[model samples]
Target: MRAEVHAYVADAARLNRQPVLVLDPLTALDCSEAGYAEWFTEVTEGIEAHRALVVLKDKECEAESPRTTMMTVGVRNLRAAAPGAMVFLDATQLARKQDPPGVARTLATWSVKETAGVAINVGEHTPQAVADRYGIELRQTLAVTTGRRDLYVVADSSRGGVASADGCNPSDARIGSYEVLSDNPETTQHLWLTTPGISDGPCGSAPASKPGQFVPELATGLLAGTP
Candidate 1:
């Protein structure tokens, strides 16, 4: 289903004249666990094109936990690519040691400071818990398709979320402010996006050699628009 959907979307995007978002699988993998400064810098610099879609593989560890190359690296890269580009974070990519609730809060905090749109795909066991941590509600948005049940959620500081800290929480630092798309920043704005298969499948990055290839349902959910 994931592969089928991506192939269809990629093909559709091509025919419809949509911007092609690309990602470097190897780079994402390299930055997965610990911060690989060199790799992160190199990869972020490579995807500098405006409006380019960036995708990252959500690697799952042996124990079925999500693995993040480096939370900051991914967010940082998104900021660099397009300050307004939505950052679709696959919770499964986070390591086991990293608590989902904590990570979610950290992400919410980053959203407040960077002004970037962030939508996290959560699993059953941790969904509500994360929602509470960041004070975000999983509300339903207009149905994109009958086959999928898509919902929307907002991530802002009014919900007790804060931006990633420097000096103190260096690993989760934000480089600069991200431009706000919609919703008021003064309060928790119910931002828009879809979350169909939030806990749908095993998370992992696409093959390093072909990052552009379809990655199925793992973290395929779009930020604000299709393809």
Candidate 2:
């Protein structure tokens, strides 16, 4: 797969040989260098000449000329090589397929405030872990998160706050022919589920004085979660 990706990148010109390969997002990527030729040809010309049912209007060529039937006459516009300092190649087999010092440079360029700035560590890693891995020092800084049980207390509670979704989105989707969508375990988890074409996933469990008011327990801290 790496060989195919390398070949395809060289041929199609995806990043223009940028150093960072960014392998995390390629979890299920399914492109092959072998398929590039067929795809490029189809995209450029072959498919249209074979499948076109009606004549297209063109200013450059007479309708009788075969070039008119080709997808792009004179190859006036379309080019396979991407136009950028970076390269981007895409092919399918239906299938196919960064970091460091760059960080120092970015931090230096931005003059990032060491004490005030906090890092967002995505996935299973803690922000502290990310900073440590990347050599970014955030002395005495902390990040609040929702998915984990970790917590730290300072003299001031206002410094950090929870970042979590306020509530679940009630599903509106249904199967074909009006079959109601059954969220099952997830549907049962919510405070209330709305009938289709009725409440439109009304928030806050649908039982309060105001129609859209935040529940009394959550009202105070929800805005902090956002800000």
Candidate 3:
């Protein structure tokens, strides 16, 4: 049923020249726990506040729990089938541990580089952290879709349900304010901020996203989700 519905949508989008959004996948379905673990090797650690989307609760040792590369591949397939459709893939924010650790505890990055024509995600705090940590912008990261890598920093200082921190569900300002996530001087605002965002191409140094552009990173996702 899911496949049929997705196919129907893809066909409709292609025929009508409409845009289609796809959420990342969220299931390892056929694979066992161990198999899933192999695919998901990195996750957030030591941080008191975190999001289940980044590191699954109780399943951190394993992958995000119930995930497979096929999920990402499906997005590619959808894009191929719907050439005319504007496919956007929104994935969760993920980071890996660095041996030396830098400005932040965890690296601000995203996974699944290829698939959607554009990628949009509510990165709790990652949107700002990515800029502060790497000294780069979010749109340039691997987080955005492989095609037009554009990231939008529309809001900040909010809690979960829509997009919130994991551990304590801190606001975007708090989570991305410093390295350890306790508190830092980098934060300028404690309230939500909005931006118009770009849609033409990836923002930052490179206009087009290459395979090895940003730190590679996905988990079970919506493939097509609602805001």
Candidate 4:
């Protein structure tokens, strides 16, 4: 699995695209120190080679848990190994389930000061509310459709303006695409583009039309203060 992940990262980098990698420490809680160190070395080497961003999730810092100690060691190793690669800490689960709202705010604040940014899963919260509470700017809005169900992806700008929208389509709708609505910092306004898919299959897709046809129009409209 780690090799496959590294291959994907290398491929994405070769294409000049940014790839997001999510790492969950809970999955390897029982691995030996030496084994985990090997994994970390591989991950750091991949990051250095691909310039990929990694999000470390589900890291526990509880006082009495052995996992907490491992988590601390893992983070230190990652920072030491890949000091230049972008890495973000995600403690949304801890914030939502175990800690108070203040905990999330503190985490967000610290992340902004320490790493690239933080990842927050606002499961049942409004984007505006989360942005206000965390004092972060709302960066992008993504609409994901799968069959008859729809999901929205919202995140703060402090985490960088990057996100992924994916879902399985088992219904007649059969359409799978992603629309990104983002704020153009230079214009102080929002701009959006929709990249439609040609098929529902994961790899069976291409841009619905030539980018030259719509890209210019969208840019012109947004620059002229037209959404």
Please give the CA lDDT of all the candidate structures: 0.34, 0.23, 0.28, 0.41
Candidate 4 C-alpha lDDT tens digits along 165-200:
322111111111122333332111111112222222
lDDT score, candidate 4, position 86: 59
Error of 4 at 1 (Å): 4.0
Over 108-146, each residue of candidate 1 has an lDDT whose tens digit, in order, gives 433323323333322222222343344232222111211
Output the number of the lDDT-best candidate. Answer: 4
Q: TM-scores, in order shown? A: 0.34, 0.15, 0.31, 0.48
Error of 4 at 206 (Å): 29
Q: Candidate order by TM-score, highest to lowest? A: 4, 1, 3, 2
For lDDT, candidate 1 versus 4, the one ahead is 4
Which digits, one per residue and each the tens of the lDDT, describe model 2 over residues 131-226?
233322211122211221111110111111222232222222221111122223111011001121222134433433343243433333223234
Candidate 3 structure quality by residue, lDDT tens digits, 1-227: 34443454456545763221222233434344444333222111111122111212111224443333333334334334433332322323322222212211222222233322122123333445343333223334433223343322211322112332332212222222211221222222222221112111242323453322331111111111423
RMSD in order of candidates: 15.3, 23.3, 17.2, 13.1
Residue 40 local lDDT, model 1: 50
